[model samples]
Target: MIRGEVIEAAMYEAMHQAAVHLPPDVEARLRMALAEESEPLAREHLRVSLENAALAAAGRGLVCGDTGFPLFFVRAGSRTAVDGGFGAIRTAAAAATARATRDSFLRPTMVDPLTRGNPGTNLGPGMPKVELQFAGDGDGLDIVAVPKGGGSEIFGTFYRMLYPADGEKGIKRFVIDCIRDGCYAGKICPPAIVGVGIGGSSDLCMKLAKEAALLRQLGEPHPRADVAHLEQELLLAARSLGLGPMGSRGVNAVMALHIELAMTHTAALPVAVNAQCLVGRRWCAAIDAGGRIACTGTLPPRETEAHA
Candidate 1:
C-alpha cells in the first residue's frame, strides 16, 4: 500500500516544482517563438521570459511573484489503497501548501472571502481545490499540480443555455470575441494558452476548459477531428487579431488553443473559455501500487519505499 507520508512528501515536492519550473513542452514553445520573432521588442520579451525560466529552474527565484492558486488533479486506480484514505490525501495537500509557503516557493494567497482574513498558510475553506477521478489500470495514482494565476482567471468566461441554433459558428464567435474584448487588454497575459469547453453544464464546462488550458501539452492536437479543426481555426483567428505577446502587435498572438467537449441536453448549450498566462506552471507525479514514484518538471525523487 502507498503510505500517507510518502504521498504527502511527493505532493510537497510537486508544489515546489510547480512554483519554480516550467514544463518542457511550454518552454519549448516559448523558445521556438523567441527564435522566430522578428520584432525587437517582442523578441526581448521572449528573451526575458526564457531567462526567468532558467533562473527559476536553477532554484534562484520564482518564475512569477504571484504563485497563483494551487489546484490539484488526481487519477486514482480502482484497486489502489492509501494508508490513511481520502482525508489523508487532503491533509497531505494542505501540509504541502503550508510548507511551500514557508520555504518561499509559494505565496500565502488564500484569504477569507467575507472577512478578508489572511490564512498565511495558503489553506482555508475551499482553497487548493482538488478534483479526483478514476482512470488508468487501477493500480497507480496520477497527480498534477497546476498553479493558475489570477490574471488568467479573470479572463475566464462562461455562457450557458445558448440556443442550439448558435451551433459551431456561434461557438467560434464567442471564443474569438472573448479573446479580443477581454484578453487583448494585456490583463490575462499573452501569447496566452486558451482552452474552450463545450456541451456541458456551466461549471463542468469551465472545469473542462481549465483542464484543457493548463494540462494539455503544447503542440498536441485534440483526438477528435472536429474539435481539432476548431482549435486550429481559433488559433488562427486569435493570431489574426494581432494580440501578440503582452498584447503587443506581432505575428504570434497565441501559443496554443484546445477544446474539450461533452454531451449536453438537447436544447441547452454551455460553453467556457479559460486562459493561462505565458508562464505556464504545472508538474505531475505518478505512484504505483508498489509505491514506485515517477514525476516530471522539478519534482524531487521519492525518498522512501511504500509499505507492504
Candidate 2:
C-alpha cells in the first residue's frame, strides 16, 4: 500500500517547490514576453520578475508574496490501495500546509470568511482546498499542488449565464471585457494566463476555469480545433487592447488563453473565467502502489485537461 508518510513527504516537498520555483513553462513565457515588450516600464517589470525568479530558485525567497491557496488536486487510481485510507491525503495536505507556512514558504493567508479570523497554519474549515478525483485504473496517485495567488482569485475571476442566442460573438465580447476590467492597473497581475469555461453548470464552470488556468502548461491549446481557434482569437484580441506586462503598454498582455467546454441546458449558456498570475506557481508528484515517491512536472496533461 502507498504509505501515509510517503504521501506526506511528497506533499511537503511539492508545497515548497511550488512556492519557491516558477514553473519552467511560465518562465519561458515571461522571457518571451520580456523580449517582445517595448514599453520601458513594462520591460523593467518583466526583467525584475525574472530576477526574482532566479533568487527564489536559489532559495532566496518565495516566487510571490501571496500564497493565497495551498491547493492539492489529487488524481487517484481506483486500483491502488492507500495506506491509512484516502483520508491520509487530506491529513498530509493539512500537515504540509502548516509546515510550509511555518517555514515561510507560504504566508498565513487562509482565514474564516465570516469572522476573518486567521488560522496561522493556512488550514481552516474548507481551507487548503483539496480537489480529489478517482480516475484511471493505474496503481498510483498523482498530485498537482498549486499555491494560487490572491491577486488572480480576487480580481481575475468572473462568471455569468448568457442567452444561448448570444453565440460566439457574445462569448468573445464577454472575455475581452473581463480581461480589460480585471487586469486594469495590474490588479489581477497582467500578462496572466486566462482560462475560460463554457457550457457547464455555474460551479463546474468556475472550477473548470480555475483548473485550466492553474494546471495547464503555458500556451497549451485545446485539442478541439474550434476551441483552439477561439482561444487564439481571444488572445489576439487581448493583445490588440495594448495591455502589457502588469497593465503597461505593449503586446504582452496575456501569457496564454485556454478554453474548456461542457454540455449544458438547451436554453442557457454558462461561462466562467479564471486567471493565474504571472508567477504561475504549481508542482507535481506521484506515488506508486508500493509507496515509492517521485516528484515531476512532465507528466501527460490530465484527461480532463479539456472537455471540448
Candidate 3:
C-alpha cells in the first residue's frame, strides 16, 4: 500500500519541478527554432525564452509569471492501494498546489467564477483538475502534471457532428482555420504545439487533444502511418499560413502538430484542437509497490545532470 504522505510528497516535488523546468523536448524545439529563424525579432524572442528557461532551471523563478492551472493525469494499478484511499490523491494534489503557491512556483490562478474572489490557496470548485484511469494489476501509480496557461486554453476549439465525407480534408480545414482565426495574434503564444483530436465524443475529443498537446514529446509522430502523414501535412499547411513566431510572420510557424484519433460512429465526426505555448511544462513520476518514486521529464539541469 502506498502511504498518503508518500503520495503527497511526490506530488509536491512534481509540481515544483514542472513549474521550474522546461521539458527537454520543448527546449530542444525552441533551440532548433532559434537557429532556423531569420527574423531578428523572432530570434530575439526565442533567445529570451531560452534564457528564462535556464533561469527557472536554476530555481531563480518560475518559467512564466502566469504559472497557469494545475492539471493531473493519473494511471493507477488495480491492485495498488493508498493508505487513505483514492481521496488521498486529491488531498495530496490540493496540498501540493497550496505549497507551490506559497513558494511562488505557482500563481493564485483559481478564483470564484461568479465573485472573482481569490481564495489565496489555489483550491476551489474545479481547481486542480484530475483525470484518472486504471490499468494493470501491479501495485504502482503513475502521475503526470501539466500546468496549462490561460492564453492557450482560451484559444482551444471543439466541433462536433461533421459529415464523415469531410474526413481528412475536413479535419485539416478545421485545424488550420482555428489557428488562422484565433491564434494569429499570438494570444496562445506563437510557434505553438498544436494538438488535433479526431473522432470520439465531444469531451473525449477535447481530452485527447489536450493529452496530445501536453503529453507527447515535440516532433514525435503518431504510431499509425496515416495519422503521422496527416500531422506532417498539417504542420506544413500551418507554416504556409505565415503565422510565424509570435504571429510576426516568420519561417517556423509551429513547433509541432500532434494528432490523436479514435473510432467513432459511422455518421458522426468530432474534432478538437488544443494548443500549448512555447513554454510547455509537464513532469511525470511513478511510485512502485515498495513506495519508491522514479521521476522523469525536466528537472533542474544541475539536478538532472547530477542524477545522471
Q: Which run of 10 residues does model 2 get worst, by summed lDDT?
A: 299-308
Q: What TM-score number comes out for model 3?
A: 0.93
Residue clash pairs of candidate 1: none
Order of models, best TM-score first: 2, 1, 3
Task: Using lDDT, give the best candidate's number.
Answer: 2
Error of 2 at 186 (Å): 0.4
Give the clashing pairs for model 3.
none
**Per-residue C-alpha lDDT of model 1 across residues 227-301, encoded as one tens digit per residue:** 898899899898788667777767566799988877888997788888888888888888788877777864222
- Write candidate 2's Cα lDDT for 1-308 as tens digits: 88877888889888889988888888888999998998899999899989998898898987888888889998887698888888988998898889889999999998888899997999888878889887777789888888999998999999989988998988998999999987799988879999999987899899889887887777788888999999999999999998898888888778999998888899988889999899888998888888877886544465753222
| Candidate 3 or 2, higher lDDT | 2
List per-candidate RMSD values in Å. Answer: 4.8, 1.6, 5.1
Prediction-by-prediction clash tally? 0, 0, 0
Ranking by lDDT: 2, 3, 1
Worst 10 residues of 3 by lDDT: 299-308
Candidate 1 runs further than 4 Å off:
298-308
